[model samples]
Target chain A: MQKNQSIEIGALLLEIGALLMSAGANTNRIRLTMRRIAKSYGYKAEYLITHRAIMLTLQNPNGDLAFNQVKQTYAQVPNFMMVSGISRLSWRIVDENLSVETVWQEIERLKLLPKYPRLIILATVALACAAFCRLGGGNFTEMLIVFLASFSGLFIKQELGKKKVNPYFGVFLASFITTMICGVIGIWYPFQHDNMAFVTSVLYLIPGIPLINSISDIMDGNSLNGIIRALNGVVISFAIASGLLIAILIFNAV
Target chain B: MDWIDFFEKWIWFGVAAIGFAILFNVPKRTLIPIFIMAALGGSVKLVLLHWGDSLVLGTLLGAVLIGFLSIYAAHFKHSPPFVFAIPAVIPMVPGSYAYYTMKGIIKLSNNSNTTDFVPLLNDTITNGFKTLFILMAIAIGVFAPMLLTRRDSAKQIKMPLLKQDKK
Candidate 1:
């Protein structure tokens, strides 16, 4: 009886960690996708994780829940990558009623694909072009510059993924490259309203920390956190603004 | 933009929906219903905006009405509320407007020589506040029911209903 209770408790902890990792997902889009994946594995209430925050859905008839560290450990590994297939692995553990530690060991035995950098680059470039077209009134030249900036960032993330560079530095380089492109546009075409469009479109890549944090705050019933997330969003907006303004100022000075 | 022109340009909503659908890997089959619902809501908003009425009131009404519609649609389709609710409302997302406001603020700062910062500041503040109000309006409409009813209804409500109630 005690053993089964332990397993249920372990699974609950795993769910909570997944909730936190998923709460700030790139957009609710990722969360939605995860729910679909979970559904394919016959896991209902996938969206419940977002609300319940923690739960024990799996229980053993013998009164022995499969509690062990392995299940939780396996769950965490996929946090950094696409989790579609992770649900499948999780289902295996659930169906077998295996110990959490055993599930982790089994997950290690399964072959997993490494994160592909080219896909990230392609997605970034495509989205950048789309955003530019949307915001800049289809100004071809502005679209070209935004594409180049996004491309440079993609290449940097690739290098970081390969362990040839640090990820934070990579993201900063990407940000600088993007900012520089926007700065040049501002200097060359000071009168056009399209520059605003160009900058706003690129802001999509700015991590959406505000929305995620806000939702997380609300889900946790923490009003302070929600307010903080909203403020954070504004601050980040200003920070991006400051970065762009400072760049243009330096350019004008030169 | 006029009514017909509104729908024509409202292609942006479709684009947003498709973009979100692809990013999230939602089933292609589910896209049409979501798109149509967003279009309906978006058209109402565009109409209200054209009438020179309060955009806040328009947004609030649009969100609440759309929220209710999404819940109904989810029931009819036998899908989760988050499924229909999230994508169906993409047209209402404040993404574009928020982008414009932030960009406006930055451009104002760039014009350091201009003494007209007051007007620019007004526009920025107005937009910033408007975006917040719009999102909160949507959340109030959507989350209020979900919160009031209690959390984790999928575990509690979905199964028994699915078993006993056949639509």
Candidate 2:
């Protein structure tokens, strides 16, 4: 019985650590939370976090290794609701002292929690991009153009994302599509700010979360992870610029 | 800038933040607070800009205020500070600077416009530096509040989150 519980606790710690990392929590918090959760169940846990991986070890009271794990968490996608749920979960486990079975079930429940419906996401994202254009000094008509441009771009992105397309390619395609749409509109009436609508329309794909996380990780002293995330942001930025540049070149040529 | 025009932009900033909330799939229960926080951050920046501060300084102040407030919201909402804070600052990100940098680079690469090379070079350099500094200011500003608050966990009842989970 003792040995089985020990194995269960080790697996649970690693699972939780990977989940937190994937959901976009910073490295410091992941380690801190993992330690707290392990301590509650009478194990001492140490963790090492990198941009692409989480490594942790569990030690029994006798100073023997309980278990060790190195988990690779995939690139992050913004899911604030999931992240918050996951963050609260460690504390809940400690506060209520949930058993291994209950905790396992809870983890499954968190993973299966439904994301936002597609229609709402589409509409709000379009509106949000439109609002960004308005904030960029776009008038009402230009905002509408931006709305349609983002609407189509986000639509293409969601469809492609469902097929498991690489995110960089997804961003590239979406920027290409949105800029093309904006390009068509500009020919009718030149944009006041020289591609203002075209630019703001694709602002939704700015990889804001990674940029924010990169800085937070640095501030929390995880400089390596921070630099890694910052590099990821740069790659995504390049994807977007290339896509938009292609569309602009095509418009100029035509 | 006119006060009425200034106030109108914050409303749009709120509208824009709604998109971020949607993109992140923020739970409906916390959506309104996120919008208000985003709006406040954007408006604060604008107000600072109107007062003749540099773009970096204005963004810093706005992000700092929003960062502190988002933590308070997270406490009341019982979620992580980041969940609220990340979405709230989306409006203030320097999207235009990035776009201009791309344009300038593309222009420079043509290698045929010597007459405009100086201006193109200036545009790229200024926009690139502007984007970097503004982003750094935002990052540091948002974090300052969190760092300052961590030292005072003795008032646990007042600041329940200061005690643990370092990030």
Candidate 3:
């Protein structure tokens, strides 16, 4: 019984970590990730992201009878706001009594998604380019061109939604799309030098993951962990910049 | 620069109010009231500046006051404080400033004719960060009161979970 409970707890932590990494709090990706994490813990966890705040409820097998008790318990956690959109992920661990090891394992499992790396890279590039375009007032035609490339990245991952394609290959295709689009924009666009617009719009893709995660880490009173997450955000931003720089250099050379 | 020029620039005050209201998803009913209030608030800053107050400080206070009033309106309707506060904040967002800074960098970089590209980018990003932080600080200040007043009641109310079936 204890072992089963431990496994469930591990699964819950894993889900929260994964949900946090996906950029944008209210997107389909975060929702899907949260659902998967909750299911792993065997608890009937549900969530809602409204204009005001993100709310969640967890129902253990004690049924609705114990729901109030669970709610009260969670209401006491001073740093609950730290979880924000990823609250479902964190709440599952708390409810199921999972350990750190279980959470770490699940975090590891998320890498299995195949296209994970590629998605990260592609998203970063697309965002950077979009920010640049918006800043430059690059015109509808320029935006349309950039959008075509970013959409290609999104399309590569779309099959993940359909389950017909492996996530790894999807990421690769997405990265290729990002590279192709950004490279073309750099060489062909008259306003190729405007990295700011590209970067700003790209900020949308910059994964609020780091921002929220760092904030959460601080709120949870774990400065080291929070700093690590903050650093991760910087690293991810650099990764995206590196990809954009490489694409631009290669495209310019050719 | 002249009165006509100055009057033209204030158009953004209205633009700011509307953009904030919509982005925060304010209900249609409250839009007009909030817009009027925001204009009033913006004008107050203008008046204060003419009287020799610091424009930035005056504007910051104006944003806070506007946020507080909007929250009060929300309170009157039994609406969530967060709901109203967001739109109230729209007028204060530094959208145009962020846009121009970013645009300058991209233009300079592409042309390769400017020695000041690096400085321009850094300055622009710094300004964007400062603006974002100020906005966030004001938001929290506005939101703090709501949390304190509603803490007990929020506990009693069972917020419906939208993704209930997912589990």
Candidate 4:
């Protein structure tokens, strides 16, 4: 392959790596998928993947560096569809010997795919948190309280995201709002297991993907990336806890 | 547990998984499989808990089952396993434990008297450790299959130029 062709492939690989990283894929999966795609195109791929960026180098058949590029990854959004879609695309490239242009087109299509409607997401998440309350021995009233709290919390989070607020701050605000709602309701209603509502209300904000990915990365020997992800999870959890603390302090004063 | 209670818990577990799956925007086709896997995992954990097993042990076993099921479902649906596995295990996350741990820490800091310090510190430590261990269990359990089956090393690819240059 020509040097220019190799350069294009390197760029594509970097793009894929960036997309996967932003979609909350672990470092192992991103590295494996990129390497597979590079191998399919008759080049060896080397990468330094971090929380904020991916630096990729493509080596030609002679073991010479054909291309090197670095791309910045945005904040992770946990889009499993994008992660799965790109993983499948890598397999298709190897199995079908797909052209670079076809691969590029497919990536674009995956990016453009529509997400689930926001209202459905909100309802289901609220219901899920309510179910969580039930599992924790909450009564029906507590479930209802949790449902409303999580729904409103999630709505605030979504709106904050649209406004391009920092994600940690958004989580903090969401947790604060959810806990306040639950706490105030508990004070008025005086029901059994009211604490269950407080416990489950802000749960919709738990950074599950990041925490899981952090551990997987660490176990897979991507210690640097793993630590970064772990720190990210810690900060988000702290944001959530801090929000809850403030709400508790207010309740204590009351 | 009674049959009615078991079924209620199972169904709720599935709903919770579906909620998170949608939140993550997993492919529509994978949602049903995700629901089943998550519900089954939750049932396993619940059953174990009812039998007097530790929460960490129950979570680890349940997550392992989910991890294995996720690999199969991913194969059938042609998606990455994490897409299914992560959401399936979300319901089991120790969110309440973490919350309690945090609350305990705050209370400890705000306490003005030394009389209650021991119990407060004890409560904080227990909750903090529970949160950490349960999280570790979940991560390891869900990752076991992939770690065992897949090699992370890159495959070697031969190019025509290499042969031509050799000739």
Candidate 5:
């Protein structure tokens, strides 16, 4: 293959890696899928994947020609559709001997995959948090409070994200809003399971994917990336805690 | 728990999973299987907890069930297991323990007297450890099968041979 062709393949592989990483895939999946796709194109690919960037090296079978490139990844978003789409696309490339151009087109198509509407996402997530409240032994009234609290909290978070606010601050602000709503209602209502609502209201902010992905990354021998992801989870959790604390202090002051 | 209570818990588990799956933007076709798998996992944990099992142990078993079932579900749905497994396990997060841990820490920082400080410290430690261990249990349990299998079920693609150049 020509040097330009190899460069194209390397760029495509890096794009795939960055997409998978940002889509909340474990490092192992990113490594395996990228390698598999490169092998299908008659090249050997090696990747140095970090939380914020992916560096890929593609070489011909004889090891004489090599192409290297680094791509900065987008912000981490837990879109499983993109993760699964790219995984399936890698397999199609291997199975059908898809050309580099074809694979690139497929990647472009996957990028355009439609997401769930924002309003639907907001309602479902709020309902989920309310279910969490119920599981924590909350009464119906507490569940209703949690539902409203989380809905508004998630709305604020989404709006903050759209405005390019720092994500950790977005989480902190969202949780603060959620806790304030729950706490104020609890103080007035004095229900049996008010504590349950308070506990479950901010749960929609739990960094579930990052926490799990960190462990899986560690278990898969990518400790560096795992540690980075784990730290990311810790910071988000700390932001949440800080938000709750401030809300509790305000309640105390009142 | 009675049969009615058990079913109620199961339905809530399913609903929670569906909510999270939507939040994560999983493919629409895979939602039902995710719901079933999540409900089963949550039920396993609930039954174990009711049977006097430790919370960490019950969570581990539940996550294991979700992890293994997710493998099958991934094969059936042609999607990654994480799609099914992650949302399914969200219902089991130790949210209350985490909340209490934070609350304890804040109180601990505020109290100046040794008498209040000691118990606050203890409560913080206990809740903090519980939160850490439960999260570890869930993560380890949900990914154990995939780790042991050493291959992602959904991405087990065959490798093609490198073409040989003619002399």
Candidate 6:
């Protein structure tokens, strides 16, 4: 194999490792995707992934080994767009036997694809919160209050997240603001179920996706990463409860 | 939960799933189908719960259906199974049960006058386990499909995973 070919393969493998990590792919799936991609290129690959980082080893020219470690800089948020995009790219690699240069360019394009607009996310989340309220059997009045609170809370979360705030702190702020809004509403108008508003307003903030992923990881025998992800979910739940507890104390609603 | 009100929740769960799909940045074209999958899972739960069944049973049944459906959706949408499976399982996350578990702990802490801790413990334990089991159900249900259909992924990648990934 040419020196240039080996270098390109190493770079491609590292970039894909980093992409899978940042895209919120679990450790097992990351290894699977990396292995498959490497094999398709007529190379061998191995990886050790934890919650915080990824260490990938690929066999290069002359049977030499190449190692790359990708440290996750940001928190993991599921972007199905990127997830699906990566999935398709791997398959395309197999189908076309594409050169490393073309595959790398495709990854760059996927990384640049814009996420859904911020306004759309906020509006939809608020409506989802109202849906939770209705699912909780709350009346229209309660659902409206939850809708407003969720809107403001998700807005704060999105803004603070962009400002590079710690993800946990963002969750805390969102839940606190949401529960506080419901608390104030409770003081103004006592409804049949004021507490449901408090519960459902922050329903949008639960780490459902991560929690499910964690369990899936464990079942796939990636227990270390799975346990870590589950612990992250527990911590997020605690942050939410702390915020809600503070609001409850302030309103003396408990 | 009467017939009318029970059916009403189907729409809400569908809407909630759309919010989740949006938040996750699923492709714009996949939103409507994701909503339907979520609502379908929720209705499965509703039917089971309507018969005075345990929430664990209902959630497990619902998740099983969602898990099976997510495979087809992933194939059709040209996305990974996790993308659809994760969001579809959202409507049955048992968030309220977990919240109640926490609230029960807080209530017990605040019980200066009340001597009865039994009910508090009961509330916390019952709800806490409900949350745990519901999560387990969702996990197992979603993964069962992937485990069974390893051949689906195996077809895409000709590499043999079992021989090398011993750990």
DockQ of each: 0.15, 0.62, 0.08, 0.55, 0.60, 0.67
> In model 1 chain A, where is the ten-residue run with the lowest total lDDT?
A71-80
Query: Between candidates 2 and 3, which one is better according to TM-score?
Result: 2
Q: State the fnat of candidate 6 relative to the true structure.
A: 0.85
lDDT winner between candidates 3 and 4: 4
lDDT (10s digit) by residue, model 4, range A121-202:
9999999999899888888888999999999999999999999999999999999999999888878886586376888888
Better of 2 and 5 by TM-score: 5
Task: For model 2, state the Cα shift of residue A186 in Å.
Answer: 2.2
Tens digits of per-residue lDDT for model 6, B1-167 = 67777668988899998888898888876787688889999998988887858789898888888877776666566677677777777878876787788788888887875557887788799999898899898888887776766754623422322223221
Per-residue lDDT of model 2, residues A1-254, tens digit only: 86777889888877877777777777777877788788889888888888777787888888888788788876566777777786678778878898989889988998888888888898888998898888888898899999999999999998998899998999999999999999998889778766778779998898887788888788778899999989988898889988888998998831
Which candidate number has the best DockQ? 6
- lDDT of each residue in A1-254, candidate 5, tens digit only: 48888888888888888989888999988998888889988898877999998887778988865898889998888899998898888878977888888888888888898999999999999999999988989988999999999999999999999999999999999999998998888778875853778778899999999999999999989999999999999999999988987887887731
lDDT of 3 by residue, B50-162 (tens): 77665455556666666556555544444433344444444444434544444454555676646667777777687667555654444444444434455322122333332
Q: Indicate whether candidate 1 or candidate 3 has the larger lDDT.
A: 1
lDDT of 1 at A208: 39
lDDT of 3: 0.46
In model 4, what are the clashing residue pairs, if there are any? none
Clashes within 3 Å, all models in order: 5, 0, 16, 0, 0, 0
- Candidate 1 chain B worst ten-residue window by lDDT: B153-162
Sorted by DockQ (best first), the order is 6, 2, 5, 4, 1, 3
The TM-score of candidate 3 is 0.39
For model 3, the superposed segments whose C-alpha errors exceed 4 Å read A1-136, A156-180, A185-189, A192-197, A200-204, A249-254, B1-167
Winner by lDDT between candidate 6 and candidate 3: 6
Please provide, for model 2 over B1-167, each residue's C-alpha lDDT reduced to its tens digit, 9 standing for 90 to 100: 78788778988888888888878877677788888898899988998887867799999988898888877777677777777777788888888888888778877888586788998899799999999898888777767666776632111324544554433
Worst 10 residues of 6 chain B by lDDT: B158-167
